[model samples]
Target: MILLKKVLLAFFGLCAGGVIAAGVYAFLAIIGVFVRLMGKTGTRKHIFLYETVIILGGVIGNIMDIYEFPIAIGGFTGHLLLGICGLSVGIFVGCLVMSLAETLKALPTISRRIHLAVGLQYLILALAAGKMTGSLLYFWQKMASLG
Candidate 1:
């Protein structure tokens, strides 16, 4: 009975792998573009600092996502592509933050308010990307199971 249950679950997981990878790729690509465009500089220090935090956090999240999901990433080729996407987006975010941060520092007029709004965007995205990457290679796994 237990053996039968295991086989059934494996079957479903295998079938779902391709769908999951495709879905994840679409999501990551969209979010990456959105994240890249979010680097707006404001006259207020609080807003400046806030946007900086958000961009930096997102870049960090992308990196962590790559590190956290090496297995089940379809194959070496797939993993490499995913990493490239993450790095491209991350670099874009980093450049934005660095440029804006420089502006904030150069300004004499800037807010001193506490800025912690929407700082977890990257963390959440990272977790999601990791899950997608980790769930990939469903087809590969199913094939391996046959051997």
Candidate 2:
């Protein structure tokens, strides 16, 4: 049924979003570990690499969602708005992770605390980003309905 198809599309979109967020977080965490091992000199390079991966992952995820859904529940304006919102959420999460990493770096004495704090911050950001991405997909469904 049409309703079932819509539900499936929404589910696919959510899965794609979750995959992208996980990729971003994992990439950053790996880079952080690498930087810690390599010392301060390689930190900047690793950070840039991590950011690039996030951006690419976000783009691919959005494209995959659109391809899988292909139904506009609202209108062009709504779809555009949703896309922008999703992008904004991704960027915000990246920036938040970076800031938290910087803050953690300042307290070298509390290594375990720093790791725990960074991990928690990343988890929270991922959850927020996932929620925003889901909203975007919902808007997409609404756009499709309007058509």
Candidate 3:
């Protein structure tokens, strides 16, 4: 029965992650437009990093949910706590990316890059982040289940 519940929870959590990612994408789309309109192109490089962080957070939350962290603790409050931690991690990732991006800005050839390349760059970042986080989660679950 517990195994079944965990499976169901994992399924639901994955679904929720997709929903959250979509919602964040929509929100980011709006913010991107707003920023561009406001002539804030200077911050354009950071936008993709923020999006990557949000996607990573949602995915990490989904994985954490597979272990039923919220129920193990209390309930909604535990979920909130987990969510906050995920978000804090995400923000940290974004800050790191932002800092690295700033350093790259000094490259004379960076301006020659095509617009479409930015999309690819973020896509790669998201994929890499998700892959690493999922693998970490898998190992964590394995170790946890052994105990």
Candidate 4:
């Protein structure tokens, strides 16, 4: 009975993880991240390579996170590596955000749906500003907590 329970738990865990990964990838695809990236860089020929990198990156990231892998890098090399990682993450996030914003066109659509014709531009500007402010506040709080 104990062995059966363990098998069932492992099976369910694997299934759940697969589903979550699929959902995440699907969302990324739907948001046009890959399409936008390739178009911008004229890397249509290298789409397969781009996709493989994304998949491998996800797997390695998950493994490192789940296994709590520790980095032993120190000094200037460590800071340089950290900076590169940060820049890569920032670029990815910016691309993702732009993809989402372009794909959704949410503010304009909402304005049209609600017949809010007059201040639609202001509404979009306000939404963007609000997002920036919220992001700044959240990061500020996170930095405070860390220090």
> Which candidate number has the best TM-score?
4
Model 3 C-alpha lDDT per residue in residues 1-147, reported as the tens digit of each score = 999999999899768777887886575454343254234446566767755766687677767765666556555576567667666666555545444454456323453554453465675578668966885687568646754
CA shift of 6, model 1, Å: 44
What lDDT, from 0 to 1, does candidate 1 have?
A: 0.55
Residue 13, model 2: Cα distance from true site in angstroms: 0.6
Q: Worst lDDT window (10 residues) for model 4?
A: 138-147
How would you encode candidate 4's per-residue C-alpha lDDT over 65-146 as one tens digit per residue?
Answer: 7789889987668756866786588679877986897788865778779999798768767866787677667765865675
lDDT per prediction?
0.55, 0.66, 0.61, 0.82
Question: Which numbered prediction scores highest in lDDT against the true structure?
Answer: 4
Q: What lDDT score goes with residue 42 in model 2?
A: 56
TM-score of every candidate? 0.25, 0.26, 0.30, 0.70
Error of 2 at 89 (Å): 11
Poorly placed runs, candidate 1 (over 4 Å): 1-73, 106-147
RMSD of each: 17.0, 16.6, 16.4, 4.6
Ranking 2 against 4 by lDDT, winner: 4
Q: Taking the tens digit of each residue's C-alpha lDDT, what string does model 1 give over 84-115?
A: 77666665655555445444563222222434
Deviation in Å, model 2, residue 53 alpha carbon: 21
Where is the poorest 10-residue window by lDDT in model 2?
Answer: 33-42
In order of TM-score, best first, we have 4, 3, 2, 1
lDDT of 3 at 49: 75
Please report how far candidate 4 places residue 133 from its true position, in Å.
13
